[model samples]
Target: MTIHQFYQPPLHWQQFEEFAVQLLAEVYDVPTAQQYGRSGQAQHGVDVYGRSRKHGLIAMQCKRLSDRDANNQPYPGGPITREFFFAEAQAIEDFPHAVSIWILVTTARRDTRVQGYAEELNEQWEKNGIDRTATVWSWDDCVSHLNSYPDLRKRYYRDVIQVNSVDDLDQMVLETISMAFNRTAFELPLHIETPDEFLQALQDTQRAVRTGELLDRKSRHVIRKSIGGWRQIHNRDWQAALGKIDKDLRALRAGVEHGLKDGSIRRTSNYLDFADRRKADELEELRSGCVRDLSAVLIEAGLPPI
Candidate 1:
């Protein structure tokens, strides 16, 4: 639900550099960024040059770091390396003034080893009177900054930040039920409006029910328990209808199991069918009954029906 997952490593390095410059200047509150590197030109390592009022001259090195796969899709870049950081540090020699703050920004996740190396390197630089400091920014750091300023996320990854509609809940419920029933996985739309708001409310309800303690309970168990709790708060007939729906689904599954044991039902890619049309119809009636009850409960719960 968080727009963080959709931050694609841009195939075009220029686009990434531009975005990073804006991101650092606006979102992260870094001031006065100047692009020192050009496409197809040697930059040593520095991509964007900026001055930090507190930290002095800052040299930002942007690295996409992901090797293109056969399909040219960006896969995970593994642990950060000291060699990568050292290369960026070498760029400080080219600058007219001493670079005080060296930042290596990558699409890869941050590694503690890289941080430790940077710290050690900084100490050595201090000993040698270089006055250089170093830091590494990874994908997660970008997410945290973007999350703080949601407008930036909207600007970059708008697809995952679309406004949710009534239909979304219906689809959500349907997909949940499908998963609960052990059906083939359906790719539900991940985009939702105000997902953080919904997640907060969900957490509040969970805390109330769980005595402010978190537990790793099965999702199906949690859902059923929540429905039962809601039923106690509101005396709704649809609550009983939901129970009946569950019973019908279970009975249908039982019937299938028995059929499989006795070799009475033939199973193919689709539904298991009996030799008799009447038997097949009876089986279908149970399925339809469960669906009807589910739709009624969804509507009663103020969710749109599928």
Candidate 2:
């Protein structure tokens, strides 16, 4: 019964810059994003030089309203205004390297006024023939990204828990497995590469079939559903079959984790021969069978096969 906490990151501006850099790296492939010059240095109005797949080169300035300032003093920074945004955008021209996007990231709550100003600024830049777009990201944007990317959540929020007590386990089995495999880490042709991410994903599907509670990186909540576990499945045979699948799924995750810890499983390599991918390969095979079995269970229960 863990209580969900608000997305309040009590961090200093410098730590926020590092957090932004790491988060950017996670979202972008082979990210070239990094924190720019240190404080009190001539940084050309850029606190972070981030990259984006869609926008190409991204220039970011993190305007964090730190809970405390340097020297451990109480320092809640001032609000971010459109005037400040304009001043920052005006200074980007001094940055030596060209960027495709200019983003002003703030820990401040979102302001529609500033957002609209950024959009208008983009148009002005376009009309002026400038080769960049202006954007604004408030604390809410970071929180949303945290929810969308599990690895980010795990790194930032160590106490995150995923409880799914309301959703139907049968439908959940179909959805959870689909969600797991469809994830960027798992998909692109499923194979275990990231052990931490893999284990985090496995918990959801495992919980769905087993009819128990587990942490989901995407969510933080405790909900009660009509049917909490597999015990609610009316067909005894179907229930028993689901139980069997859960047993194998649990073992599959355990074996992979243990293998990873023992160095028998190497990251980013699925070679079954020398890498000792026995457990991972088993999980792959079981995943395929599990989907087929899931469809069978749904169909047998007089429901449409997913």
Report how far residue 98 has shifted in candidate 1, in Å: 2.5
lDDT of model 1 at position 39 = 75
Question: Best TM-score goes to which candidate?
Answer: 1
- C-alpha lDDT (0 to 100) for residue 176 of candidate 1: 44
Put down candidate 2 lDDT per residue, 112-182, tens digits, no spaces: 88788899899899999998888887777777777777777877765333423423335544443334334
RMSD of model 2 against the true structure: 16.6
How does candidate 1 fare on TM-score? 0.48
Q: How high is the lDDT of residue 50 in model 2?
A: 66
Model 1 steric clash total = 0
